[model samples]
Target: MPQLPEDMVLPEGFVPSQAPQPPAEPRDSATVALVRDTDGGPEVFLLRRVLGMAFAGGMTVFPGGGVDKRDADTSVAWAGPTPAWWARAFGCSAELARALVCAAVRETFEEAGVLLAGPDADSVVADATPYADARQELVERKLSLAEFLTEAGLVLRADLLRPLGNWVTPPEEPRRYDTRFFLAALPTGQRADGSTTEADHAAWQRPQDAIADWAARRSGLMPPTWVTLSQLAEHRSVRELLAAERQITKITPRVVRRNGNLHVALPGDADYPEAS
Candidate 1:
């Protein structure tokens, strides 16, 4: 986590340009932690965001983004839990729930070159390279998931996703995202590549090793990513991890001023539990 700028020095003759505005409304978003099993353990696919991006710039994060309006298209071929069941799991309307799931699948494919779709619900694509043209179109928003799947005669494998948690950006941040985190095992025979424009690099790393790198200051990670990775580092196998159920809770940290110092406090901070 980056240090809070509570002790920055001000210029001698600095003048404020404008009054600070209230935090923006949190936009609905979805993130997918793509994991794969290795002889050593489970490793997750991670992307290092480019420095020029607006949010989480230069930070290592899971593949995800804001929900697209087209993501809610009910006409898209879907196989697995119904929108109503997803609504119950995610604590949102059926429409928004549909969009969130679609965003998760779409963003994962866009960022990691892994598509959780296939000819039917029970199957997954053996190779995703054939969809390279559609992937580009999806990235450019020239084609929606519905359009691509419809044309390709594929169905969205909604069962591949497992609900993890929900987090809202702190109220003080200029950009806020009401993000829902999801976990999915990487599809068989499909490889993830680091070709997205948003990321400078992407790699598969064991959760524990990623945490060690962050601790050693070899990479940057936001609080959510760090905390999630810590939680994931405990699992011994991807199968066991995916089989487990998650208790999703909304965590929005509060900015607390204590003894002339500033801190972002989580709900259970009294014990100051070590994340890893």
Candidate 2:
């Protein structure tokens, strides 16, 4: 298990309750780690969420968000692995698997301006700048991913995504999410932008460098992001990283009190049993 920094402080408004309370249900969400091969190694795209956001405010994260209701639409033009295949991969129902995949693609576009869909099944959009208006509409909930793809005559390229893992927010958290993480190579010609209102800064950083930034206290990384970066740092190239087989499992880190301070404990930690 990866270790959290000793100086780490909980996010704003994340105070634990004084008395035991029922854990809030976690909302289904998707997150994508966009990557590209670099001379130095594989670099993953990350966005620093604006400090005022209710969830992971001021933390750097991959492009992703909650599954939109329309993301589960069966009418979405899709290519590559079927929802059933994805269902088996994530150990969820096919309907939810479809929604998760669609959410991954849609959120990637809305947050990063990178579209994984294409006009035809065999190709991906070379440039997404033309769909700026649609991106806004999607963000504003005025358009569903299926509606946008159908009108644009494109198919969601499921082949471009690979399941990374699933993480459920700890029950102690007032706001929680059952977030599925996916990895996608940055499309060849599409450039990612940080224009979304959710993030104040965006950039591509080599995974190890990101970990280093966290170590030096220059950037904030939640446990999931930190662990993902550590895992990515072990691979030498994008192909290697993607081709590496992953045994998808659910990892729910728990928050515990340790020596009068709050700490996050992974499954294997000694204090994990005390979490709640």
Candidate 3:
């Protein structure tokens, strides 16, 4: 578990008028850890969310968002692993597993300019730049992933994704998400563009380099991103990283008081290194 920051301090003379509101419902979402091998080491793609966003603003994170209703559209063309396979992998219902996989692929294309879909079960889009218009439509919610794939005759490559873990937002947050994390290799010939409106900038950085940036306060990383990078930093190549087995577990932070200061605590508090 990652270390949590101290609780916010309220201004003097500020009194609560009503009891605290319950935490927002946790929305079903998916995030992708897009990685590739480079001369230095394996690098992961990251996006700095626009500061004005409602959640995790200005934080470096993986490309992902809430699952769209259309993600569950069973008609979408798909190749590779079946929804049932993903269901078992993610411990989700088959129906939701389909939506999660679709959401993962869709969000990756919309946010990172990488399409995990191909013309057929075996062919992936060598270059995704040609589909900029479709990508925009998807971002705008004007185009459903199912519709885009059907019109373009593409198949969702579920085989390209590997489940890493799941995370649920802490109850203290006003907006929450039950997000699933996935690992995927950047497709051949496709370049990730940092053109999404939601992000001020995006790029690929080696795991250790990103951690160093965070330590220097040059980049902001949420607990999940920080911990994930730390784990990935141990691997020198994407192949080795992916070949390792991961036992997925859910981690939720809880409020605790220590030394007269309120702070969030996660599992293994005494041994867990602080990432905040």
Candidate 4:
């Protein structure tokens, strides 16, 4: 089990899945994380949630959020592994896992405009221009990820998502995420331009530098953001990092804290915890 955090308070009205529900629609959320190798080392993309928003408002976060209902639809083409594989990894039904991956890809595009799915330039799905417009519509709820893939003849590229961590909010928190943060190198031909809707500002910083900025109070980062950055700081290179990832057979979300400060433990580590 991941260790726990001490005090984690996001903006109000953003309740955790643990919050009281009327015996319906329990436990629904997921997250996608993109960690890249930069001059500052492994820098993870961080987005600052819009202040006064529904959830985690003003908190700096990885590009992810609650899974959409459209995530479970399976009519779309899959670029890689089947939903069944992701299902086991998430401890959920295959349908749910498929949906989570779809949300991850979709949210990554919606929030950051970074397209992680699709074929390499030389592959058949050569043009990404069409998907750009489709992505805009998907964000507008005019289409689902599955429908977009089906219509565009694209694939979900499930293999592109690497199992990172599974985090459930503390039972006491009002809003929680059974979030599975997946890791991926920035895909070719895609840019990490963050949208202003969810984030006030976005940046790809050296994980260490970001942490330093947080510690120095230069950049506003919440505990979760700090913890994730600390973990990313350990990887010196993308190749050396992804090479280590192949050895990752299991990921258990543990919250680590020292002197009341909280953090999340990486898959191959037991260093920090995220929740109480």
Candidate 5:
């Protein structure tokens, strides 16, 4: 790893000062932890994004990504909470926050094959496989989030998502996301099985087990990911974790390079594992 200039600091995001505008570009993202109650404790879904992807490649992550422009539409029916409450949840403008949560739910549906919506979650997901396929195309700009949500008869469960954390990639990484993390219980009858193309594999694992694997170097986790999962392991139940989120007053994370590793410093001084 190369050492950063002692006096130089990188911007939080990248922008080409001079280049043709891209027809489509990556926006900041919102992601979530699909948690479920287990006798052992709260388990969360995890996916290993394909190594070929530009960002966070080959790493285990909770399902999530950037806000889609179509997510801004106010018409997306939400079953859980009001938009104002959602705004406060994600700590952004009401419109932007609503979009982030909506995108989170939508992305979860797209990536994990689980819907936090519909009258019957199991049936909704079963019926949604085709739309889910379309949402995947949205990533490639073949379709839009608005079209996917409307045509599929799916409601974006913005209320179900509880803001948990926010992180941005370090300066050195070419790809970055000012990502907001949300937490929600796994919708009943819906399971999180990831697509093999974008993700190598997926599973629902206890947060502690996930962290322990990372700490033991058994599972690959970047620094930010390591700490986030560790913090999630503190609570023994999903209800308790949800309660804890209500008391959260901050989600600012610091990106840095140390000891040959990129790190995301969270509140209380925890960090995700970065490469050396």
Candidate 6:
């Protein structure tokens, strides 16, 4: 059985329970792990949520958020794999698949200042700086992704994204999310910046280096982020990593009490405990 890292600490006020009085329903969300090729390996973009935030505060994570209702609007132009294809890949409805892809692209731009879209089907935006105003509006929710794309005369390049995994937040948490993880390579002529209010810091780091930081207590990483980085560390280049085939599966880690302390157990652990 895999053991929770010795450095792992339960959230403040967290108490192991068989079940909450009522478990919060997981909200549909999406996250994108943006990577760029480097001499050492692929370096992934990460954002450290501001400490004052409610969820995953002070933890490094990818750029993403809950799906917006407007994300499902079919009026938004798209190029690449159809929604039906994404639905099959993620084991979700076509409508939700469309929303997830849109959310992924939208959130990446809103949070990282990196747009995974293009003026047309054949190319990606070389620079995102020109859309600063729209990006902020998108962050403020004043403009929906569909509206922004439509007004900008751009298409959501669904082909630029690849499904990484699906993870459901455990039932013990007050806030939960059914999150689909997506992998996207940093476009050639664009740069990622940490301008989002949610994050206090942003940087690009090799997966292994980030893991080391977590191990040395220099940074905080939630389980999902750690696991994703570990998986990413196995590949040497962005192209190789993106080309690797993945089998999408839902993984829900469980929290349990052991010797008066809380611990997390992955699905295949020797004696995985259920919170509900």
TM-score (all chains, Cα) for each model = 0.89, 0.96, 0.89, 0.77, 0.76, 0.95
The Cα error of candidate 4 at residue 115, in Å, is 1.8
- Residues 1-276 of candidate 1: C-alpha lDDT, one tens digit per residue: 223223322223121233126557899999999999999999999999999787878889999999999999999999999888889998899999999999999999999999999999899998999999999999999999999999999999999999988889766566789999999999999999968999998999999898788777788777778778888888999998899877787887655445554455566665232331
> Per-residue lDDT for 184-219 in model 5, tens only?
887666667786467888998998898767656566
Ranking of predictions according to lDDT: 2, 6, 1, 3, 5, 4
On lDDT, the candidate that comes out on top is 2
Each candidate's clash count: 0, 0, 0, 22, 8, 0
Off by over 4 Å in 3: 1-21, 260-262, 270-276
Off by over 4 Å in 2: 1-13, 274-276
- Candidate 2, residue 214: the lDDT equals 87
Candidate 6, residue 119: lDDT: 94
Superior by TM-score: candidate 1 or candidate 2: 2
Model 2, position 200: C-alpha lDDT score? 94
lDDT (Cα, tens digit) per residue for candidate 3, span 218-242: 9887777777888888888999988
For model 2, residues 72-177, the per-residue Cα lDDT tens digits are 9999999999999999999999999999999999999999999999988899999999999999999999999999999999999999999998999988778899
The per-prediction CA RMSD against the true structure, in angstroms, equals 5.2, 1.6, 4.2, 5.3, 7.1, 1.7
lDDT of each: 0.85, 0.91, 0.83, 0.65, 0.68, 0.90
Off by over 4 Å in 4: 1-26, 119-130, 245-276
The candidate, 5 or 6, that scores higher on lDDT is: 6
Which runs in model 1 stand beyond 4 Å of their true positions?
1-21, 257-262, 270-276
